[model samples]
Each structure stands twice: as structure tokens, then as C-alpha cells.
Target: MATASHPHEHRTDGLVVTSWFAPGRINLIGEHTDYNDGFVLPFALAVGCTATVSQAAQDWSVRSAQEPEPVVVRRSGLAGADAVPEWTRYVLGALWLLTDRGIDVPPLEVTVDSDVPTGAGLSSSAALVCSVVRAVGDHLGLDLDDDAVFALTRDVENDAVGAPTGGMDQLVSLRGEAGHVLLCDMRSHDTRPVPLDLAGHGLSVLVADTRAPHKHSDGEYGARRRGCEEAARILGVPALRDVSGEGLADALGRLDDDELRRYVRHVVTEDERVLAVARLLDEGRLPDIGQALTASHRSMRDDFRITVPEVDTAVDALLSAGALGARMTGGGFGGCVIGLLPEGDVEAAGDAVRRAFADAGFGEPSLFTASAEAGARRV
Candidate 1:
């Protein structure tokens, strides 16, 4: 982890503005499996959230250029799911979770800006959540470990913010290394650092934002997690990780509901894909990993029901344009699709995707190549 001078070391006009950059993440595989206690391989992207924070004299205050009114919450009186807007919940939730963990910190004021497109499935929320949490930790002089920091961020999203999310986003955001992917074990919180050597293949990763935003508060994401939990309960396991692909099949055979069977299949298959990708990376077999990426996308689309038509179209367009693999990256409903392609072909592939979307009458999308960047740090 990178460290910086304390926020108090630099003050201006009676306020100390500490800026932190929290990288957005892309799931290389294992979609919708993190909440299931299954594996997920997410790499931090160069694109991310940047937050400027200063201590507040009165209460915890937040003001975003993206919003109209400043949100206020007391240090002892943090905002909950009901009182906070969705956009502000990331910061509020982080504070609540950190406080619950006994990190008694004072109130703060935060402002955020980001290149990571919201609702693009590139983990804009995670970036924002991690940034605020890190900034607050620094301001409070808390010397928490990376795991503790990640836990605080996860709790904010899953509990205080009322989003049924997994630990992958927060974990990667806090622990990611430049030029590497974090192969995270959601079940044990263990991470394996895998080298991301895309340059050797002359490949670049293009993230195309569909401009369709997904809000986890809507319950679609939560419902899927509930379904996985139900499957785990029926299988007599702690989580879906305890059930293998064949084991899931055997468990589903006892169930009469087709929907339940499909959900189990996705979880089991996704877990297998994640492990496969990790193994391939370990062996330096980068090209073979693309197959797992494509398969994971298909599973998320067909079984998880998270990918929307626009996302599907984007992936298809990129694949047709010679992308080695393409998939929707985030919580799914509407977001960005990431494509792995030869660096020389990136522009052409992006142009082809744009034309395809225009033909379909969808809004023009934003495209950019992301580096495998470092995680959260004071700037």
C-alpha cells in the first residue's frame, strides 16, 4: 500500500484538503459469484474516483458537483439508507461502517470527481466508496490494515447503503497493484497477485460505457443474491462455494424449479471460470484466459440475467470486430462492456462498436483504454 503525508501536514485557509484516488475495477471473470462466497478475478483500472476531503468543524458534510444540495450527517449521527441519497450513500455508509468497527473519527467534508462513468459497471460506486473511506481513515489517524479498510467499505455498501454487494470491489480498490490483477478469494479474503502482461500480447483493454446506469437499491441485484443464498441453504452448505458444478447439478436435480437450477448453474460455473483464469495467469497463458472471459459473460447474461440488451449488443459488436473477448464488467443491468483486443486494433474495434450502436439507435458511447493501475492512495 502507498502512504502519504498526513492530511494535517498540508492545510489551506483553515481547511486541509486531502485528495485520494480509488481505482475502478473490472472483473476478468466470476460475475455475480462474489456474494456467493465464490471466486472473482478483478483488476483495478486506471480510471477511477478522485476525492478531495477536508475536516468539517460542525458535522460530516458532503458536496458533489454532480448533485444540487450538500448532504450533511453528524459524526455521531451518520446517515442511513433512508436519510441519504443514493449518490451520497457511499461516503455515509463508509463512515457508518468504520464507526461500527470502532474507528472513532470526526466529521468531514468531501467533494468528488471521477473519470469512471457512473452506471457503466466499471465500479464507479466502489471507487467513490473506497476513496472516502481511505480519506477518512487518513484524517482520523487510523492505522487500519488493508483488510480492515476493505471490510469497512464492504460493510458500508452491503449494510448501511443497503446494496447486496460482494467484497471484490473494495478488496481490489484497496489492494490492487499497478500492472497486476488481484485474484481475490471472497470466502477467505486471501488475495493472489497475478501479473497482467497485456503488453506482451500487444493487447489493450477498452471499456465502452453504455450510459445506462444501474442502482443496486432497486432490489434486482439483491434478489439475485437472495436466490444464491437460498441455493446454499438448500445444498446444506455455508455458501455456493461449497457446491461444485456437479454438486450443484445434483442439488438442483432435487429442486423442481427451473429458475433455481439456472441460478445454481451460473454460480457454480462462474466459480470454475474464475479458478481457471487464475490458473491460466499463473502459467503465463494469457491467450487462453480470453475463453474464460467470454464464457463468464455468457453465464452472466443467460443465467444471472444481469446483462441488458444494450450491454449484450456492445459485447457482440466488439467480439465481431476482432476483440479476443468482451463482457459486461459491473453489477450488470446497464454499464460498460470491456473488450480485450490487439493494441493496433483498439481504435478500429471501438469505431466498429460505435457504428453498431448508432445503427441500433443507442446513444453514442464513451470508449477508453484502462491501465492496470494502483489502488487507493492519497494523491
Candidate 2:
């Protein structure tokens, strides 16, 4: 990931300040399995959100270069769900969530800025919330451990932003290492640190933003989430996580509805793919994991039906350009595609994708090379 300078960084120009960072994340193999209480393999990106806070004479206020009108929130109204300044609710809601967990919210002026691309499925929202939380924690002198950080940021996203994202984004954002992938079991909430050596294995991670608006607030994302839950209920299992190994066939046969079966199948199989990728990474066999990544894209496209035309086109172009493997990485519909390409071929791969998009009359995608980086912490 190419790092960009954000406004929140480096501010000693005649004002006292506190700055904290939260990095964006990319899932290498697993997709749409986290909400089903399954496995995910994700790594933090160098690109991330940063928050800068300084004392204000008035109540809590927030400003960002991305938006007009600084958001001001009164501490009294923070407890209400109908908080003011809707766009900045992520920050406001975080204050309330923290208070709910018995931490005191301090009044401060917060300016949140991010280099993480919005709506590209790189966990930008999570990064933003985590960055804000870190800034607030830093300002208030509240010691929020990693676990509290994960839960509070996730609650802000789900409750305040009304985004029905699973816990993977926040978990990875909180616990990421500079050179490791977090293998998190959503069902168990058990996390294992796995080493990542993409460049060492002659690979480069490419992220292509198709520039499609991707928001999980819509019914499309929630519908799939509910469908997966229903499928788990119908199968009489706690979740799809239980239907693995030799028992997978039995679980598939037990499902009566074809649509429900498809959802369950994707979860079960995708979870297995996460484990496969983790194992491959462990053995230093990065090239062999390409097939699993492609298979994940196919399952999301055919069975889960989340991949848009732009996503498919970009993935196809990357694969055709001799990428090791290509797939849509985020909550799918319209977002970005992550591909593992041979080192030194990213420019050609990017060219091929741009040309393919141009030929298809689609908007040009923003392509960037991604590298693993550290997670949220105060600067």
C-alpha cells in the first residue's frame, strides 16, 4: 500500500495535539464468511485513517477534509440514539459506546482524515472509527485494551453507522502486525498471528478499486446476511462453522431449499478456503494459494451473487495479465478486487485492467500495490 500524507499527521505548528492511526485491511482469501461465524485471513494495509485531536473551548466537534461543516456533539445528546450531525455519528457514537462500557468521554476537537479509499472494501469505515477511538482514548487518558477497542469500534459501525458488517474489520484493524495476517475465528473470537511474506515469495498485492459505490446499509448486503443466518437455522447447526470437515456433505444434503443451500455452501467452502490459505502461507507456498483465491471469487459470483460486472471484469483482466490469483476482496456488489501478481508485473497488470475497463465502457479503476502494516495506535 502506498502511504499518503493525511492532515491528521504531524501537527506541532503552535498547538498541543494528539494523533492516532488505524490502518485499512484486506482479506486474502476468506469472503462473506465472518458474519456466518467462520474463518477469515486478513492483513493490515499501510494505507489507513488518522485522527488529530486538540482541546476546543466548546463541546466536542469534528471536522474532516472529506466533508463540509464541522460536526458538533453535545455530551448530553450523546446518550440518545438520535444524535446530531449524522455524518459524524461514527465518532459521536464511539463516545457513547465507550461511556456505556464505563469509560469517561473527554471533550475535545477531533479532525479525522484518511488515505484509505472509501467504499473500496478495504475496511475504511473500520479504520476511521478505530482511528477516532484511538484519538479519543489518547486524549481522555483512557487505557483501552485491544479487545475493548475491537468491540467498541465495531459497535459504533453497527449501531451508529447502521452498517451490518461483521467483526472481521474491527478485529483485524485492532490486532494487526506489520508482517502478519490475522487468522480470526469469528465463532470463537480466537485469533492467531500468521506470518506474511508476499514480496519474499515473489508476489505483489494489487488492489483495484472499481469505483462503484459500496455501502452495506442497503438491503442487498443485509439480505445475504439474514439468508445465511436462516440457512444455519434450517440446517440445525449453530452456524456454518459447525458444518466443516467430513460433516460438510451431510450438512449440504440436509438443506432443502436450493437458494439456502447455495448460501450455506459458500460459507462452508469459503471457510475451508481460509484455512487452506493460512496453511499455504505457513508452508511458504504462496503461489499454490492462487487457485483458492480464484475459487473464492467464483463462489461469491455464482453462488453468493455479490460480484458486480466491474468486479468480474477487473478480476478477469488481472488473471489474464498473469496474476497469481484474483478475486473481489470486500463485501462485494461494487468495490475493489485484490490480486496476487508476480513482482514487477503490477504496472502491466494495471494497464491490462484499465484497457479492459475502457473496452467495456466502465470507469477507470484506481490501482495500488498493498503492503502489510501495523494496526491502530497513538503516534
Q: What is the lDDT of residue 279 in candidate 2?
A: 94
lDDT of 1: 0.82
Off by over 4 Å in 1: 1-8, 78-81, 98-104
Tell me the tens digit of each residue's lDDT in model 1 across 1-379: 1223653335778566677889888877778888888888889988888777777787778888677898887665344557767788887777776666666657678888777777777788889999888877776667778878888888878877777788889899888998888888898999988987899868888888888789766789888888888877877889888888767668888667777778888889889988888888788887777777888789889888899878899999999999888888888899888888889989999999899899999999888888788889888
Over the stretch 198-307, how does candidate 2's per-residue lDDT look in tens digits?
87888898999999868878899999999888888887888778887678778879878888888888888999899999998899888898999999999999999999
What would the TM-score be for candidate 1 when compared with the true structure?
0.93
- List the RMSD of every prediction in angstroms: 2.7, 4.4
Which lDDT value does model 2 have at 151? Answer: 79
TM-score computed on alpha carbons, candidate 2:
0.93
- Residue pairs with clashing backbones, model 2: 1-370, 1-371
Residue 37's lDDT in candidate 2: 88
> Per-residue error at 150 for model 1, in Å?
1.1
Off by over 4 Å in 2: 1-16, 77-85
